[model samples]
Target: MKIYADNAATTKMSPAAVQVMIRCMEEDYGNPSSLYTIGQKAKETLELAREDVAAVINASPREIYFTSGGSEADNQALLTAAQIGKKKGKMHIISSAFEHHAILHTLQRLEKDGFEVTLLDVHEDGLVRPEELEAAIREDTCLVTIMYANNEIGTIQPIAEIGAICRAHQVLFHTDAVQAVGHLPIDVEAENIDMLSASGHKFHGPKGAGFLYVKKGIPVTNLIEGGAQERGKRAGTENVPAIAAMTEALKEAVANLEANTKRQLEIRNRLIEGILEIPHTALNGDAVKRLPGNANFCFEGIEGESLLLLLDDKGISASSGSACTSGSLDPSHVLLAIGRVHDVAHGSLRLSMDAATTDEEVEYLIQSVKEVVEYLRGFSPIWRDLMNGKKEFIL
Candidate 1:
């Protein structure tokens, strides 16, 4: 069937984005930093793209800073907040335990440099508690960075509530909204977000394109130093073509968000229902609070790696967890954080649908998964032991 179900990893660029990219590359091929007529046209395209991207999140064009992608944006956001906090004598940061590696690894580096980080527990539902986050803030806490939506388990955090609490406490709030930006509606001002990060490829835009949103008066510093591009905060020849394509993609996504959400939700819920019909299977996150196209499950008595390989052989593309960490041999940290033990966590499957996914495709996926799990379990010694009651079933 050649089903590609891993939309959380990335998506195919839309035709509108491709056309905009081609137009920019072919006709508007001038440096936005140059001071000539051609360059002026390119610069105009860049600024208009900035405005379009800003409008998607209800942000001002001046507040948006282009970047290579989500990782750079995340690093810059953290660096900016940490530097600002350092000057103000605050060195503590708060985040959730299940955040993407971009945020988690940066927090680790910051910890080495004398910043205290508190990663609140995401309970079995994979949702952070707003009260706990509010209680974690202190006089020394300067930033509370949480992801708007999880990349693996697909849990959508209570960003509005968390942002309100951070604002009440006079702390800066940042969210890595890489997975939520185009899929979900975001209003940075209304959400009280002080800083935000987004990537392009997550929503049918080309990769290597993204932007960081910093509320005015937050003083952004250069993550790279050179020319005075990106308001002197990001120094490089601006990628005008990528930026324009990304902006077009964002605008299209926002325009069709309601209809796409409705369609994907139906497929996602059906996938969940069909998959859970298997014995000893369980969903990983809050069903209703997750992204419309995401469904993660842990099937007892099978290995995730083998499941993926077999599914691939069946012409279906899927993942056990985050694509960024797919090479690792260890089980997913996000699944573990949600209280899944190692055995169950190792048997996980993540099927992320998209607007193109159809009900027939989802039905094929359900049947294929059922057959694969049953076949894998037939020869697994672990399954044998569980069936014989030598080892207890977790899921």
Candidate 2:
């Protein structure tokens, strides 16, 4: 049986979402920018979508700006914040080392352009301490950007506490909630977040559709310059169909968030418990503070790539790190930032489930992982030496 456990990277588009998208593509194919009757219908659909997305985060419809995806939204947040706050002599931006590259690389580019960046370190459990974040804020710090939950390790940061600190410092706060939106509850108002980013695909919606929430009155420069679209904040013709489908998907995902969270927590715990029962295996993130659907761990004396290939052969899909950076040979920066040594980092695996995941599937994965780890460890000289209590073998 095929088991898909990589929901953190992206989920299969829900049937409901697909149906809505198809209807829009076939019947409602009109430019929202046009003033014709069909265009008016499309524009209405788009407006309703905005309301749905806004409802999920408890933000007003006008505060949300649709973007191509999470990357663009993140870029818009950082660049806009930095640009608007430049004249205030507060060019420094603070973020954790475990942020998605969307935030990390953008901050790196800003640094190259003479902006100061403070990359706060994460604890061994892959969590950034709120106190550490508060300490990192400075007079020249324009914005504080952090992820709601890590994509690889599944560690949920203390975003509410961090946001409160930023509020007290009077600094703009942004969070890349790409992984946290549908998986967990988020209230921009309660968290005091000035800006937030999320991707549709992350929550079973179509790809290439996302939104950025910018609190009203926060001045941000437009990332794209063109004819007035997205109220002149984002450029190009709005993708009405994808936006509508995304709204439906978001509503469905969040409607039963409590039930889904409970189910995922049960499945995730079973998977983690099963994996920990295996020898020489260790969990990679905080047990209590993580996404309910995420389970990341490392198997000593085995390579993550090898394990992934084995699992794939068994019809199980998984990942070693962020799907965006999985092709690179270098280890994940997020893993390294959490103080994992190269060897442990190299052996890491991330297994994230979703609302559709089943108990049988989890059991199958647990069994498959056990067999693969045993098979791999049998060939490892380190395992053999340790088993024999012989540690003096010279290379």
Candidate 3:
């Protein structure tokens, strides 16, 4: 049952995205920088893609700037906002503790450069409280950057509320919406967003393709400095083919967003319910507020690496947490932020199913996970310790 349950890592590109990419590669291969006809054609394609992406988020086409992916977009947004705030004598920034490393590491760098950053606590439910965020804001708060949805636990943040708070305080708000872009309905204007970062691969588009939404009038700092492409903000030749592919993918995903969310929710809940039936297993994040396709859990015994390997043997691909940090022996920081102990955090599994996931596949996943966990626990000394009352059970 070779079920690919790790959509959070990256999704298989949709047929439409692939077709568009191929067509662009073959027919629109010219550099958008040239003044020739072929180059102009490629340029048109690029603008069209930008327009489509902007439309999906209720943003102006002029406000969208293409980038390598979410990480670059995040860097651009944070730095640009910081620059803007610095001119106004604001140096403090606010964000949540559980933000993606792209945002967190950038914050760390800014900290070294004399910026004070306050990371609000995301409660055990993995949701950041807007009031807490508001309270953390200071007169010098330049930016309030938070993720629209968590990458590991999949808890959807209250972006609109957070944005409103930032707007009321006249601070720039940035959201890393890489995981929430096409999967969730987004209206940047209605949500009071000043900047947004999204990656294409998260929504079944080609990797290395994404865009940053900087509200009109906000200057974007160049992450890549070279040619005058991307309005002279992003240097180098534009990736026309990948950009076209991502646009089509984003459109397709948004066109069916409601139906996809509903279907995925049903499948995800079923999977979660079945997994919870296993003793000493607990679901991470708020059950109702999480993404439709994300179901994360921590078992009391056994390591997540062993569980992932065994699940792979069963043809069920999953993860312990973010794919970026999968190679690390350290447990997921997300789980730790949510108050999961080291032992429990090490036993985590994250199953992210896409809209196309099937019930039969989910059933196989349930059975396979149950078998693997039970099998690992059977031989685990930690399980024996918990059973014999030598170690206390946390979950």
Candidate 4:
């Protein structure tokens, strides 16, 4: 049925967001940097957008710094934290092993810059223990960065608990909430978060737009030194159209988040239940402590690429761990971090739904997955022996 089940990676932009972008392109195209009337109107619109984004996270508009996307926001947050830390002789940063590449690679670069990093491990269900983070905090630890929700397995971290720990330690706390925004509730003040990152595309907003929230009074060096924009925190001309669209999308997405969450949970549960009915299958993450729309599973005796291709043939769009790491023959770091072995991790598939997903589509996906897994396993010698109840011995 041509179903698209990769909402975790990105979702189709909502019609309201597109309408706002169209209006901005057609009428509000003036440069916000200029001093003319048109520029003033554009500037006002940008400020309103900032307020909308801030309201979504319960932060002041002055704290919001728009960026190109989630990756840039993540880089800015981590780098800014490191810079602030250096001023106080605090150079150590702590993050979980299951964070997105945006955070993981940023920390890797910080390591090259001679900063110490501690990558905490996740449990088998893809959850980092709050105590582990509390234990990781130290006198020289400047920042504790954790993801609000996992991109692959759909596990939601205890962000409030972790943030409280960082607050108690008087250390800065940052969360990559790209996947969590629009799907879950977030209050920076209530969570005691010092910084947060989010992307537009993750929440049905336009791509090429995002924002980083830096709490008031946090000292951060400018990442881009150019025309004074975003209160001298971010530089370059503002993208009025995209930013406007992002604000509209965030408002709409967060307005009915509770209802959307209930619907998504229904679809995810149905999909997971159907998949578990298939023999030799296992779910990849925590059943209860996960995002509403995430349903990841692993099938024995089948390569994830083969399964994805077969599903594609059935007009069902989905994702595979191996497909995401197509060039690298390595399994997903998140899966491995959550205690999955390389072989099992290679057979994983991530099926994320959205508010637009239908029950029939979920059913179709479940049936398609069953046929594909059975077809792939049928050809395996291991399956043949197991079916025949044959004896086996291995070194």
Candidate 1 error regions (>4 Å): none
**lDDT of candidates 1 onward, in order:** 0.94, 0.90, 0.94, 0.88
Q: Which ten-residue region of model 3 has the weakest summed lDDT?
A: 355-364
Q: What's model 1's lDDT at 149? A: 95
Per residue, candidate 3 scores C-alpha lDDT tens digits across 289-335 of 99999999999988999999999999988999999999899999899
Q: Relative to the unseen true structure, what is the C-alpha lDDT of residue 325 in candidate 4, on a scale of 0 to 100?
A: 56
- lDDT string for model 4 (1-395, tens) is 89998888788999999999999988889999889989988999999999989998999998999999899999999999999888889999999998889999999999999899999999988899999889888899999999999999989999999988999999999999999988899999999999999999988999999999999999766789988898888889999999999889899989989899999989999999999998878898899999999999977666878888899999977887423355566778888898877666777889989867887888888899998999988797656765776823110
Report the CA-based lDDT of candidate 2 relative to the real structure: 0.90
Q: What is the Å distance of residue 376 in model 2 from its true position?
A: 1.3
lDDT of 1 by residue, 1-395 (tens): 98999989999999999999999999999998889989999999999999988888889999999999999999999989999999999999999899999999999999999999999999999999999998899999989999999999999999999999999999999999999999999999999999999999999999999999999999997789999999899999999999999999999999999999999999999999999999999999999999999999999999999999999999999999999999798999999898999999999999999988877899999999999999999999999999999999988
Model 3's alpha-carbon lDDT is: 0.94
Candidate 2 local lDDT, 252-360, one digit each (tens):
9998799999999999999999999987788888998999999998877778888999999999999999999887878888888988777667778899998678888
- Candidate 4 has a TM-score of 0.96
Which of the two candidates, 1 or 2, achieves a greater lDDT against the reference? 1
